[model samples]
Target chain A: MSAALPPFPKPQEALDAPELLQVGSGAEVDEPCLRADAARNRARLLDAAGRLAAEHGAAALTMEGVAAAASVGKGTVFRRFGDRTGLLAALLDHSERKFQAAILSGPPPLGPGAPPVERLRAFGCALLRRSIDELDLLLAGEPSAERRHTFPPRRFLRSHVALLLREAVPDADTELLSHTLMAYLDAALLHHLTEQCGLPPERVRAGWLDLVARVTRTDPPA
Target chain B: MSAALPPFPKPQEALDAPELLQVGSGAEVDEPCLRADAARNRARLLDAAGRLAAEHGAAALTMEGVAAAASVGKGTVFRRFGDRTGLLAALLDHSERKFQAAILSGPPPLGPGAPPVERLRAFGCALLRRSIDELDLLLAGEPSAERRHTFPPRRFLRSHVALLLREAVPDADTELLSHTLMAYLDAALLHHLTEQCGLPPERVRAGWLDLVARVTRTDPPA
Candidate 1:
């Protein structure tokens, strides 16, 4: 807890953090400013890096492995990402874009075509899956405790929950309710329950459904 | 994070940690071995320390201040608790015991006589008040995230909430539900909301009531 740099910067100041689907804002990325072929190369490297992370955990992702996976030179990997920290940040931003896109417009439950309660359930499950798949990546990427709630990705996720909660429970305090709901899905708690306490994915998912029902005043799905 | 010690130790390892009220089993503590006058003296010192924590916050609760407040020598204060860390640990244990005692037997809503849901609401409000009052002390004493869920003081508090949740929502998953409820009153979260976000204490207290109602599927108090 010294001057050690956090893997990611504050959301508003995270110049490189992908702008996660800010409603009404189109294409909020830093616009890499690469030529078409170079941009395609960058995407390829990130995609390969992501696969390595998902398959072997983020801790296993190395610049050389990324270069080998993408069939690029190790120097190219270093030049592209600066170091392991840079690669991880880009990896999170890469996955966050996909996640943001899915929640914004990709499908039914998590996107626009489902009930608020259903959306809430889908959102948590999706996040849980991602957290599990990218456990080390996320735990490493986590901001300091003081900045955790205000981090951009976190803000985006919390707002999404609040929106659905407001729709699902107009009579309740949805803002606070959203915080309560999001707390269940926190990275630290998830790590404790799943990895430390050895709860399987199904139990965690079931808990999420039960929680959504309790907060939304709905029956759990049959 | 390095091996550099946090201001506090793990609860179980905290040699001087006050024994919390263990349900069904009764009081579990390292009983102070003292004669009547010595025990009274120890209590007086602890009481003075608690007053200092409550009045000026725990950061200001120095051995010198406690000695002056309790009309004892500084050497007596240090000898009684070993050092600053020892004194703080003892102070927290002292507070934890009082808090546990209140919930177990003190009176209506916060204690055993009232309904579980009522007790749950009162528990959060009371905890939020104490967390706000002892924000610095609790924040410094927070266990590392990995051990947070299993920390003895935290486990004691969570179990108490779980017991109430069992009675209030027998149909639900009380274990996970207790975690949800506890998360809302977490010392770090409370500090962020009150000290960082500037939410008034009344708002936080109201939010707690709303959360209890939502999780319990009851109407908020009008």
Candidate 2:
């Protein structure tokens, strides 16, 4: 599958360029201006909160829980995030940044060192995993219908898929196709399939690969 | 394209059956118990409201406009539907029933008596057209993310698509693929593509046909 496709037109430079990889919506907490130590403290707090969310669900996440989990004072957690809503937003923003970094520079398949098809497959799987892990947080943060597609994080991710699809299926309607591809990985749909319908994660993962192969007109990796 | 595929297996009976075509969510205005003339009056009022919504966006739809358009007293409109919210719900219910009737027994292609793949193509085009016409109403009525896939009207439409996909590509994951196909016709997505991105309706329609073709692995009709 890898050799059958042309190399992704210009994987590294095109993907690595900061302009192409900006996922921040500007509404998230400004990180660049935070002093180094404060930024470290925030990151550590978010890490603890992320673990709490993954283990106990986002609805169960609390500042006090994160504080105790991170061995920080409750006041410290409060001083950092302000309220539960702020904590939730910061947690999502933190995860989004980490996921964006992984796509831009982390490693092969998911990052930029593999065939576009492989990367596309890897991307969906990784996103599905993340969605499953933070379903509550994602659902709670879902934008209104009018704003859902226009949301910056969504636009950024959709653009990334469009870029990959352009490389894999040059003749396709990549913009529309990217939306279809992203729809398959939608948080709402994932919740319905996994939580409501009881579809196993493996089945959903397999469906993603199958869908990518069908859209790209390639055989699924055996 | 129609002749290339097998005839839709038991199209008329399968699709015509009331059980297979039920679209009501039980929350919409109940119509069965209304007196005959009263039902006709309600339908007439809804017809006027539908036109009002389609011509001047759903936001502009009002009891006064509908009463004037239907040549009925304002109190009649208010009495039939309790308020603007009730009017909106009834308008949507009226359209849903009409659309359901079309798929159940109305005509070839969209109804039955056509190959499954052709029906699938026709289904998407018809849906996109309807969605374009009632974009606001649909978006306003969009269920929350948690309830989205489980909503009865949505579930019925998805089941319809899944049934078509079953006949068209028996080996594929029709459940997941049906969701993908329906996602293309989502009101929010349509709003984004046409209203936000400024794509023409014909292009969005073309994308639907292309998506159906790709998903079914069939050649698009010339």
Candidate 3:
């Protein structure tokens, strides 16, 4: 049965993007249109809300809490983000942009300097940490099954993993492998492992490293 | 960072079930209470419904279509399965039982008497084919992300994979690896890969074999 299947494509050709990858974090695509100080104020509110969510939980993140945390009027927050749902979406978008920046251009390992395998390791670890911090918010924003793969942030992240896999294991099916790797870092899976199954985050992180090693056929970093 | 993490438990300990694995296919647990004739009649209705779904797709499946197909009254179909939702769920349940039987005791490679690695490969291939045939129905019945990992049918399936991985790779974290393997065979991922991405089912099947070989550190069968 396997012998009858078509030959696998070269990793580079198979994983090549036909169009430019959509790197824009959703909701932040409109950032430049805001007046400079308005953008700053929005950033400030999101930052305050992010801290509150991180310190307490996403359920604790209210428009009023964000207003008080940022020392802006509650009306300012309402005007900026409409309501609690809008505020949560903006908070997620804010964190996603920061995460993307770290991977796209921050320091080594997670950024550009490290080797592909090492970068892959750092990427999952960072994502695991970020997901743990924002599991509730991430779960709340999960796209429907139909849209799950097509969602822009998810596509961008998966594309990043695919790109790294192409560099790390150029002879393999990195396109599919990337999805498998990304599945390990999925927010819902993280929630189940941590909150439901009661596995420690460190154990899950170690599993990620082990998975990256196995998938790429590389030795774990010493 | 990895050293600070606690050691992974032996595969046996980690994968051990505290309770007997719930082998019951949901909706079928109530089977014994019905009179034998009523049960036979229900099976006949489900069989008709399943054939209609397979031939014309799940959306084309209706109470009237099932009744006509089975040469029974529409009221009988309605009474047996309640409505279209009930009918669809029963159709899926019927297929799940057949699939479980195949894996549990039906034949070699897929059933018994095959090497663990071979069984794992055949298990995925069988699932991929089943998923393709029932893609529409599976996507429609997808559990919410919170419940996805906990859904009884899903847990039963995942436990099977985890058990196989334990045999195939005793030193690895088979519990975590099982989730990684199961994610590949996920209905949503299958839908996205085949329908949305236009990959043929054979390509997806080949990918599954490749994944099994990589995760188990074995060569694909010659």
Models 1 onward score TM values of 0.79, 0.89, 0.92
Over A53-124, each residue of candidate 2 has an lDDT whose tens digit, in order, gives 989998898888999999989999998888888889888887888888999888979999999999999999
Clash count per candidate: 0, 0, 0
lDDT of 2 by residue, B82-173 (tens): 89988888788778888888888989799989999888888888888888999999988888999898777777788889889889999887
Measured over all alpha carbons after superposition, the RMSD of each candidate to the real structure, in angstroms, is: 9.9, 6.8, 2.8
lDDT string, candidate 3, B1-222, tens digits: 562336665543454452233533355667879999989888888888878888888878889999998888899987777788888888888888788888888889899899999999999999999999998888878878888888767777888888899899998888889999999999888888888777778888878888888898887777
Q: Which runs in model 1 stand beyond 4 Å of their true positions? A: A1-31, A59-74, B1-31, B34-87
- For residues A70-185, what per-residue lDDT tens digits would candidate 1 score against the true structure? 99999998887788888898888777778888998989898889999999999998999998888878887877666767677777888888778868987665666777888998
For model 1, give the interface RMSD.
14.7
Give the poorly placed runs of model 2, Cα more than 4 Å off. A1-21, A24-29, B1-21, B24-29
Which pairs clash (backbone N, Cα, C closer than 3 Å) in model 2? Answer: none
Per-residue lDDT tens digits for candidate 3, residues A1-222, read: 572345555543443452233533355567779999999999899889889988988877788888999999999999988789888877887777788889888998999999999999999999999999999889888888888887767877888898899898887777778889988888888888888887888889888988888888777666
Instruction: Tell me which of candidates 1 and 3 scores higher on TM-score.
Output: 3
Weakest 10 consecutive residues of candidate 1 chain B by summed lDDT? B1-10
Docking class of 2: acceptable
